[model samples]
Target: MPHRKVGSSIHLSGQLPFKDGELLGQGVVGRDVELETAQELARHAALNCLAAAVQAVGDLDRVRIVQMLVFVASTPDFGEQSQVANAASELLIEVLGENGRHARTAIGVAGLPLNTPVEIQVICTAV
Candidate 1:
């Protein structure tokens, strides 16, 4: 399943940066991919999370993001995981306003599925 719901909480599987069924940027940040591209990937993944949340809940306005875990495929020297994740956070705020504010964890990973630069998982609650 793309997401699971229990009571008021919804848990989404890791979302990758995909557009029109095509994977977006790939490779490790601070190496094969630039920071800007990685940021865009992050935003795209977050949008996927929101889309999954809507599919799970049937209505997006009835839910608010509670927390998020962002994994960035990056070189060991990359120190901008938070910066990459910020793009997603910003997108959430842009789409949901105050309801989008959330606790988040931005982590750098050695690799990710499909070598995608970023992946995101979201937790939301029905309001």
Candidate 2:
């Protein structure tokens, strides 16, 4: 097995810098939140996650994203997780250029932290 370096294992947390208790509706709180739309929430989650990941590295030049996964907490009828995941994918390309393009997966789950509508993770190769 190939050994994974500590740098490669580093993970970052990204939450939309919305003010606390701003109220995204009955079950939501924070800025850029969509009260009734899963797609919008997914997009916000992806953007926030990527921003946090980039900040974790402290420099964009050291990044080589290998994969991305987005998790959407939603009701059973939600079928647009992939579209929401695109929000993250698009933002990464904007920030990292071609290097940001990556393998990705988007999934819908029953629930998440603070009843958040979305969360994301990234695997990156670091220099």
Highest lDDT: give the candidate number. 1
* lDDT (Cα) of model 2: 0.61
Measured with C-alpha atoms, the lDDT of residue 4 in candidate 1 is 91
Leading candidate by TM-score: 1
Candidate 1 Cα errors over 4 Å, as ranges: none
**lDDT (tens digit, per residue) of candidate 2 on 2-117:** 12346456454434322243423223322334433644555555555555555666667777667887876656765767876787788778878887898999887776666666
Question: Ten consecutive residues with minimal summed lDDT in candidate 1?
Answer: 54-63
Per-residue alpha-carbon lDDT of candidate 1 for residues 1-127, written as tens digits (9 for 90 to 100): 9999888899999999999999988799999999999999999999999999899888879769999999999999999999999999999999999889999999999999998999999999878
TM-score, structure 1 vs. true: 0.97
Candidate 1 local distance difference test against the native: 0.94
